[model samples]
Target chain A: MVESSPPTRLDALLDQLATDLEPVKPLDDRPTALVLAGLFAAAVALVLAWLGPRPGLLGEDVQPMFMLRSGTLAVLAVVCVAAVVAQAHPGVGRNSQGWKVAAAMAALFPLVGAVVAFTDPAHARAMMMMPTGWQCLRMSLMTGTLCAVPMVLHLRRGAPVAPERAGLLVGLASGSLGALAYNLHCPFDSVVYIGLWYGVAIAVAAVAGRLVVPRLIRW
Target chain B: MTSDEATLARLMRESQGGNAQAYRQLLGLAAPLLQRWFRRKVAPHELDDLVQDTLLAVHQRRASWDPARPFLPWLAAIARYRWVDRLRRSALRNHDALFDDISVESGESALIGRLGCDRLLALLPAGQAAAIRAMKIDGLSVTEAAAQLGQSESMVKVNVHRGLKKLAAMVDEDA
Candidate 1:
């Protein structure tokens, strides 16, 4: 019986498989979307604290400075972002404690935000209605949250589908969604410039999210 | 009230019967696993599309899953098919058996394709090949891959976090 030439070695086999995929670019700039979001979340919360409650609908009464209270919620959002990032990482939940930590953090974002908003809504009202940059900041904050939403959704779905343009997609969704949802209630200031269509500007920030989140996380 | 044999297994069964609640539950249950699996295979960015497609497939063909079997194996089959599809699109579809291809090439040029990637690649969960392909070959910015694939950039980042480690291990094994 003729024996075939000796089979190739396994070591040699894998060596043949390597190609110019290159080491991932250093994570220096990547994955910043979440961190910046966290930072922004905290910053927005801080601004609200200084500004005092978010505005009420239809321009109701204003309230006292309640930055500290809102700060708690903002802090909670940052923690939740970190924890969610961790939770989203593989194998962390198997440890049980990691799951609890992540769950707690996730639960806390809205929880703390709600508690502060309810316990002393004046700050939320003030911040919401300030007419100053607060409105835009609030919008940005919400936009960030929206951007994060799909990522969380993607994770829960359990397949890494973001093969390309993750940050851009996030930014676009956030920008359009934020603009669409918020612009509905826009004061429009009687100029009726809605036709001027400035809402598209929000896409820039969403684009930023697309670039930033992946780098920091380096997925 | 299905007792846990892992979250997806129970939900997969219920979802097959067209239970939206069960399907939603299955989506949640499957999400993290899919994220981790895809992350391991590809860059952090591509994860979003991978998850999106997988979920859409699961939702679209929920009936194909047989609850009588282990959820993971079925999911594994789904994942494997996805990987193969991706491999064919990229350059990694293996025409030769692992043993057969080992000796045909040499030199650093050939070394790119010949590096003991299989040893380390096998060490990783099978799903991550897609991730590796996106980052390495397709030259996608992680953000681009993440958005296209419908996953968190961070999730994608974490999945490919260990390439250097895996490579190091392979190098050590080779030595």
Candidate 2:
């Protein structure tokens, strides 16, 4: 079946490849990937249900600050997930700038916390001494880790040109999802606590993803 | 999209649907295009292997392509990834003779013609790019590269490794 007047090795190889070809389902689109990631969210919900919601999340008296923070985290996690999904298909989605903007917006929580700490010595000490901060950190990371498993597995299904960035996105999305999951149970709503604990947890998750995910997903 | 691009997209759509003839035609057309693409980026001796490697990658990763999108950019992205990967491995292997006396004829096409070593190097940090340029492209000894760049010998090695690593990570973005 070689058509060239003088067949080359590549033509032979090409023929071999074509002979072995079979129908393949294309990789999942962005929505499908998001839904796959969402399946893990149910695990987060189960854990939250076991732990019990932050006492009053469902009640009318819930703080608007809590709603605002949780909303921000939810949006950030979705954006990160979308960005990571785009990584699987090269040239399909090249909007690397989208996640950066979302990340910057998310950073404002920690930035405000830093400003509060630096500007007011008394409140800074109170924020540092808060008893539940470490617990929030642990739970957030645990939640994120749960979300991360499926995301990593999802990324492995395709060829990611930037494995490191994709790994980081996996970490960020899962970490934020983790924070959101734990936010339903966490009692602390202060900008200082959320900033310090959630920020560190997400940062740790992102760093861990960057370091580890590439090795797992590299093609 | 051009007529060729449209034809390629159609062929790929057929290939995904389990049409072997379309797949063969797709690969047949793709092989020469990849050869021209890699010509400017790789040594002449390495060109054929790189093209084959890329063709194989395209076959392996064909599922990642969406029928709605134009085919060439996806092909280009995969090609760039393979090119960077080949360079990274070669850089790690430290094959001194591979790059020697390398000269490439200019390619006639659009997207592939724009890529060259200079453009590839520009993606890295200045320090890393300089180190790769001296040690890999210029074939300088580590000691010579260190002296030329005015840094410790250890730094040159570090920069080259980091540069190659960064190049692999950034390949997807170039498309």
Q: Assign candidate 2 its CAPRI class.
A: medium
A1-219 per-residue lDDT for model 1 (tens digits):
011456333222222222211222111212444544554545445444544434542244322212222233244333433433322222211212232343244344345545666666676465345463346446644655554664544433332223123344444434433433343234432111221222223445446666765454322
- Name the regions of candidate 2 deviating beyond 4 angstroms: A1-5, A30-41, B1-3, B98-109, B113-118, B125-159
| Candidate 2 chain B lowest-lDDT run of ten | B109-118
Instruction: Provide TM-scores for the models.
Output: 0.28, 0.88
lDDT of 2 by residue, B1-175 (tens): 2228889999899998899999998898887777667665655567889989989999999999888777887887788788878877777676555355655455365645443335667878899998877875566778888999997999999998999887876676653
Give native contacts recovered, as a fraction, per prediction. Answer: 0.00, 0.63
Per-model lDDT: 0.42, 0.79
Model 2 over residues A50-145: C-alpha lDDT tens digits? 777786788888888889888999899889988887777877235376888899999999999898878887887897787777877788787688
Question: What's the CA error at residue B32 for candidate 1, in Å?
Answer: 24
**Each candidate's DockQ:** 0.03, 0.55
